[model samples]
Target: MRVRNVRLIDGVSAQAVQDAVLECGDDGRITYAGPAARAPEPRPGVRTIDGQGGTLLPGLFDCHTHLGVPSDRSLVEAALLTDPVLGVLQTTERMKRTLDAGVTSARDLGGLPAGFRDAVAAGLVPGPRLQTSVGVLSHTGGHADGTLPGGKSLDLDYCEIADDVPGVRKAARRMLRAGADLVKICTSGGISSAHDDPDDQDLLDEEIAAVVDEARRHRGRPVAAHAQGRAGVLAAIRGGVRSVEHGFGIDDEGCDLLGERGAFLVPTLSTVFQPLDPRKTTPWRYQKKLRWNERAKENIAAAIARGVDIAAGTDAGISPHGGNLSELSYLVELGMSPMAAIRAATSASARLLGVEDTLGTLRAGYAADLVLCAGDPLRDIGLLSAPEQIVLVAQQGVVRKLTLPERSGSCQT
Candidate 1:
């Protein structure tokens, strides 16, 4: 497949190539992507697509997502009351919507079952390429602990209640055995956990070290920590976590620690501003969101200023699925340049997921996952917020979504 008459960002370059042409081979890999004047001639009977002066770039990546649960349901209902079969069906539809929104790749931080990833890879579902952290490990009363006041704990497949160093090690091995691509753990409290404040530290340093050691040493998998407070963030970094999710309470010292350790921060800034149904969101959750909303941007901006790597993530289960790209606009507002913001969702995110070699950039020998927008996103990143602007989406050289202007004749030249 060949796509021509477009501007290309390539995801690695600082600028776009005008009148660019991109070619993908039958083997699902890019063959050529550069200025049209320097491109090779099309093979006989090959399909061609005219991009109509659109901007083509590498397919986007949502570094953090939870595709298993419905967004409208509260945590308690989603974990305890959701029917297993119905939940799978709902998640499948959400996956299609996510792909339609142009997210070709996503990392499920927690709450996603591994079967969805297998299904997408096997072509049984229409969705973005997925990497999952089968479940999340947390200490008792931590952010992931879903216990009721009556002493009954939530029986969620995605939540593992572990305590101390030995218990966490065992839980980490269980997740790895379950085919988790990465191990996820909660080191601090969050908005949804009504029992603890967002600033409350949850896990011990030894416990974090044990999980990280278990994950990294056993199968060479990376660990992602749900850390929002300063102490938790620092502990996760020191324990060799690969990424820190939601570092809302990080200070300068924490920023310096992150920079020194070379850990990427997947800031889910959209979580604070996400619209929630009043009937579902409790009063305490709403109050916690308001408090975090006030300082989330400032802390993330400070991290960017300190040269800490920032990757884009929406915490999509909190925000809505299919609106993953909205996080980029928030990053731009947090002082990242348009190109930088795009990179955060593209190349930088792929690096965080450890798939930079085969994905991310629009270069030859890479997977042919691409997206075409009606206008240049560099001028106004908000254009991405409008779903209509997404003209086409392709994964592994196969066209998944396309909306081109009706031409008078065939595209073949």
Candidate 2:
């Protein structure tokens, strides 16, 4: 397929061509991506789509998400009541929204339903290219300790409780054997969990190291740690985890350590507040996210200043799944240029997931994942979140959505 008469963003440094052309083969790899004047002639019978002078960008990626949680309910409620039938149906519908929002790739940090990744890979579902972490390993009484209110303990589809070095290692291996593409370790507690403080570090150093070491043995899988506090962030880096999730408490020293360790930081900016109505959000949960609010922003700025790699994530499930691009706006608000914000959501995230060479750019031989957006994202990053603004989408050389309609719900802040 050929796309011409467009502005192209190649996902390198976010420098855009005001007008360009792109060509992709049936195998879903781009044949060329550059200026339209020097474009190669399309073979007869190869369908070519007119971009209508729209902006073509590398499809966005959400680097951290939990697909199992229902958008309309609290995490606790979803955990207690969600069943398999409901889980499958919800994932199907929820992921469509995610795809329509211009995201072609998502990394599930935890609680993605079993077999969902395979279904997406096989084209049974309309969704992003998913790399899933089956569940998170939590310490006893920690973030994902399997206990609900009233002291009742039961594991959800997304969490597994483990303790100490041996237990963490065993849990990592268990997830690896359970068809996990990546392993998630809760080195610190989080906002939605009822029994733990987000600032409290949970996993021991040995346990984190064990999980990282064991997880990487499966042909080099990446490990993401839920690290909120300074101590946990430090420990996760020291343990050699590839990325730190929800790094809300990282300071200048921690930023230096992250740069030194060559670890990526996924800051889910939406966690401090979901854009939806307050009545729709869970009680006390939003407050947990708001904890250390000022310091968190400062820390993020510090990290960026220190040249720590920043990737965009929404902590979707806890926030809203389809609003993944909103994180880019938040990044922009935090002093990143619109181009840098887009890179954080695209190429940087792809690199963090170890798919940079294949999925993140519009370069030749790269996956044909492109979003034809209506407005100039470089001028207004908020345009990216609007489904109405997304004129077309191409993932793996297949057009999944086009001729966009007015979005059902509001897409902007």
Candidate 3:
């Protein structure tokens, strides 16, 4: 397949290459991505996509997502009532929506069974490439704990309730044994949970360390900590987590620690900015979200200013899944150039997932995962959030979605 007459964002450069051509081989790797003048001639019978002077860039990555879980539903309701098979089907559909939104890859912090990763890899379904944590580790009454007031534990499929050091270690190992690509732990409270406030810290420091240690022992898999409070953020960093998810309460000191420790921050700006309706869940939940709404924005901006790597994540289950690209606009609002915001969702996220060499860039030899937008996102980052502006979506050289019916062409030998 060949894509021509496009402005290309290589996922690493600060500027776009005008009048570029991208050629993809059948092996699902890019053969060439360069200026049209230097591009090789199209092979016989090549499927050509005329971008019509649109923008072509690396397919985006959402560093944090929960595939099946709906943001509008209460976490407890979504966790407890859904049938296992139906849940998988629902997740499958959500994945397709995510792919249609132009995200080629994602890292699921929790709420997705790891088998789906294999399913997508085997081409049993159409979705973004997924690296799943399988389940989240939390202490009793922690954010992931869905214990009802009636004394019944939700026992959610994607949450493991483990307390103390040994229990956390065991849970981490269990997830690793179950094919988790990374370990996710709740180090702080969250907005959606009924029992804990966002300012409340959950797991013990030793417990956090144990989970991280176990993940390292398992082929050096990275650990993502669900940290939202100042104490929680610092503890996660001190415990050696690879990335801090929803770091809403990180202060200057925590930012310094993150920089020194070389940890990435997934701000989940969409979740932070999402409006809270007291009628949707509970009043306390709404209050919790309101409390950190502005503070998270400021703290994350500080982290960005500290030069700590910021990877784009929507916290999708807490927001809408297909709206993943909306996070880029938030990042731009928080002081990143449009190009840098794109990098956070592209190359930066690829590096975090340890797939930098194969994906996340429009370059020769890289996986042919690409998105064609109707306009230059640098001038208006909001273009990415508009589904109508996403002209085409290709993952691993397979065109999944294309809106430009008039521009698609087939060239003869």
Candidate 4:
């Protein structure tokens, strides 16, 4: 299949090439990318598409997501305890929504089991190409543990709670044994956990080191630390965690450490401005807690200045799925150039997740996962949020969603 006359944002910079052509094969690799005039003649019976000179980019990626779980407390608890069938169904629907929004790939930070991952890989569901971390590992009463007050018992099957270095090691091995592709550790308290303070560190330095070491044993797949405060961010960096999840109160020293260590920072900017409803299960306490410590703007600026690789992540279950592109806009507002923001969500994000060799860019021999928009995202990042502006979404060279019809064209081999 050949796509012609499209504005190309090749996942590197904001500069869009006018009158570009992209060719993809059934194996999903991009076969060509260059000026339309120089494109090879299409073979007989080859599918042809005219992009109308719209913006064509490598598909967007969300570095952090929770599949089949709501941010609401009761629903999360119920889902964890319920049968796997419902969870799979919920994941399928959420994945479709994510694809509809032009996100071709996502990393499931938490809340998905190995079965769900297998189902998605087997083509049983319509969704993003997923890299999943089975439930998170946390200390008792820590951020990922899901412990509540009033003696209410939250299911523990999804999360492994550890209190020491040995415990952390054991838990990491358990998750890997259960088919985890990556490990999630709560180094700090978080907004949703009912009993912990978001500003406080939860895991000890040794415990964090143990988790990182275990992740390394699995060929360096990387560890995602749910860190909020300065101390937590520093601890995770020092302990060799690959990425810091929230980094709400990251300071200059923390930023320096992360930069020196080459750790990526995933600032889920959508959380800072998420619409809150006090009547929900989390209530005003969680909302107020988030509002007080939301330092995404300041921390992001610091990280950017310090040369820390910034990746786009939305914490989708908390903010809302399918609006992941809003993170790019927020990154631009926080001082990243529009091109830098786009790269962070695409190439940079895939690199941080250790999938760069196969995904992220739009070069020949790379996956044909791509998106076509109506305007130049380099000059206007806001074009990402306007759903009506997205014209087409393709994953693995297959047209998943198309808002425009194919153009008329014919060419010989």
Candidate 5:
């Protein structure tokens, strides 16, 4: 496949090359990338695609997501209790919406079941390239415990609740045995949890270390900590977790530790502005936690200044599925340049996810995942918010979505 006359942002930098041609082989790997005039002659029966002079860049990635689940426990329970099959079907629809929004890859933080990863990989469904964590590990009454304050116990199948170091290690190993691609640990309380405060550290440093140690046993799999408060963030960093999610109350000391450890921060900014809908049913005690929005932004800016790697993630299940792109705008509002924000969503995120060798950038021997837009994203990030501007989306060199129909005429030699 030959894509011609496109402005190429190779994911290496902010510069865009004009009149570029990207050639892909049958195996869905980029074989050639250079000036259109310098591209090799087409084979006798090869297909050609004209880019309509649009900007082409590596596809965006959402580093945090939850599948087979809803942010609201009531909705999740209702879906499961009413019809299990229908619940999975709804999850599939959400996945499709995520891909249609041009997110080529996503990391499922938790809530996915066994065999779900293989099902997606086997082409049984149309969705992004998925990497799953199975279910999160939390202490009893911790963020992932799903316990209410009225002594009512919610479903705990989606998470492993550990109360000690040995329990934490056992839980981490269990998640890996269940076919998780990574390990997710809830080191802090969260706004969505009815029994805990978001500013509190729920897991001890030793317990977090045990989870990280167990995760290291699985080669290539990293530990992701759902940390919100300063103490939790510090514990995650000290425990050698690869990435920190939320970082709601990350202070200067926390920022310094993250910078020193070279840990990646996935600040899910969309969660801050999540609407006050009845479906949310967030606890009133947790409402005070939302006030950390400004502080979180300041901490993120500090991290960026201190050379901490920043990646883009929307905490998708908390917000709507297709609205993940809103995170880019928030990052920019928090002082990240548009180009940097794009890189964070692409190359930087891939590196953090340990898939940089094959996925992130547009280069020879890399996956042919690309998104073509009508305008340059570097000039205005808002262009991404409009679905009409997404002219084409190609995954593994196959044209999955296109705004304009293919031309009928043969290639112009």
Candidate 6:
């Protein structure tokens, strides 16, 4: 299929082409993408379509999401009570909402199993191209442990309790064996979890290193650390993890260390301004968020200024699934330029997932995942939040949503 008459944001750079043509092969890979006049010739009888002067962009990627499985107990009970069958129906539905929201690719931090990713890959599910961490590893009373202070532990599907280097290593291996694309380790306490200080260091340096080493050994799936506080951020960086998630307490020293180590940071700003349920938030979590919100943004601004790489992550399951794209606007409000925020959501995020070579850009040899918006995102980044503004969404060359009328025409070559 040849798509013409659109301004293309290739995802490689900030510039958009006024006259562009994108050709997708039967194998769902982009064959040619360039200016209309510079496009390669299409085969005979190949169908061509006018994009109606829309803005074509590489489909956005959401780096951190739970895919609607609910990390907390209240959300889990609600899901079970509301659905008659396994959460499969609800899970797929939420994922489709993500795709419908113009996100074609996403990484699931937890709250999903290996079967889900396989289903999406095998065409058994209608959702984004997904990479998942089957479960999260945390210390016994750490962020994801689901244990109240000095109390019995609650069994949860999304978390595995691991206290030491060996325990964490075992948990990491289990997730890898379960087909996790990356390993997730809780290096510190978090806001959403029960009975733990968000600023307290949870994992030892050796334990962090163990997870990273174990994951990197098996196909080099980089370990991601959930660190919202100072000591944890420093440990993650020093331990050589690929990216730090949340990073709500990263400081100047931490920022310099991140740049020096070439590690990336995925900051979920949406959670700060709009938490899972502001009204239901515990005083502890509320105070924690309030304390770190401004500091996190300041660290983010510092990260941006210091050229420390940053990616877009919404902590989606905490918010709404389809609301992923709203994160780009938050990044912009936090001091990123509109184009910079878009890149962070797209190509830059693909880099975080280590798929930038093929998935992120709209160029030859890349996956045919693209979104065509009615307006140029470069001019108005907030337009992405409006479903009406996104005229079409294509995942791997398959059109998922198309509000634009199909225009049948011969190649205008």
TM-score of each: 0.96, 0.94, 0.96, 0.93, 0.94, 0.94
Residue 406's C-alpha lDDT in candidate 5?
54
Full candidate order by lDDT, most accurate first: 3, 1, 6, 2, 4, 5
Tell me the whole-model lDDT of each prediction, alpha carbons only. Answer: 0.86, 0.82, 0.89, 0.81, 0.80, 0.83
lDDT string, candidate 2, 1-413, tens digits: 77777888888854788678888888988998998877777755666777777889998899888776766676656766678688779878888989998989999888885588889889898998898888888898888786767787766756777887888888888888778998998888776677787778878898888888898788989899999888888888999998999898998887888888888999898775454454665567656655567777888877776778998888898778788888888888778888888888889989998999898888899999999988688988899978878888889889888884322222110
Which parts of model 4 are misplaced by more than 4 Å? 71-84, 281-287, 290-294, 407-409
Q: Model 2, poorest ten-residue lDDT window?
A: 404-413
Please provide, for model 6 over 1-413, each residue's C-alpha lDDT reduced to its tens digit, 9 standing for 90 to 100. 77888999888776889889998998889999989899888756666767888889899988899885653446536444656355777788888888888989899898788787889889998788899988888887788876554575556666888888788888888888888888988888887777677688988999998998999899888888999989999999999998899988888898889889888899888787675455776677677777777888887777777667888888887766787888888888877888788888889999888899888899999999999888777778888988678778988888888887664447574
Instruction: Report the lDDT tens digits of candidate 4 across residue range 1-413.
Output: 77887888888744667789898987888998767777777756667777776888898899998866755445545555667677667677878888888888888887777776677678877788888888798888887765557666566577788898888899999888888888899888877677776678988999998888888989776889999877788888999998999887788898888889988899888887676666664564666555654465677677777777888899988878777798888888878888898899999999987889878888888899999888788879999877667788888888888888774445622
Which ranges of candidate 1 are over 4 A from the true structure?
276-279, 405-413
For residues 1-413, what per-residue lDDT tens digits would candidate 3 score against the true structure?
Answer: 89988999999988899999999999989999989989887877778888989999899999999996877677676777777788778889899999999899999988788888999999999999999998998888998898876789887777899888888888898899899999999889987787887778889888988888899988999999999989888899999999999999998888888888988899999987777667776777777777788899898887787778889999998899898999999999988989999999999999989999999999999999999999899999999998778989998898999988533346511
- Model 3 RMSD to the real structure? 1.7
- Which residue pairs show collisions in model 6? none
* Clashing residue pairs for model 1: none
lDDT for predicted candidate 3 compared with the true structure: 0.89
Over 142-234, each residue of candidate 1 has an lDDT whose tens digit, in order, gives 888878767887767678888878899989988988889999998888878857877887778899888888987876899999998787888
Which residue pairs overlap in candidate 3's backbone?
none
Please give the range of 10 consecutive residues that has the lowest summed lDDT in model 4: 71-80
The TM-score measured for candidate 1 stands at 0.96
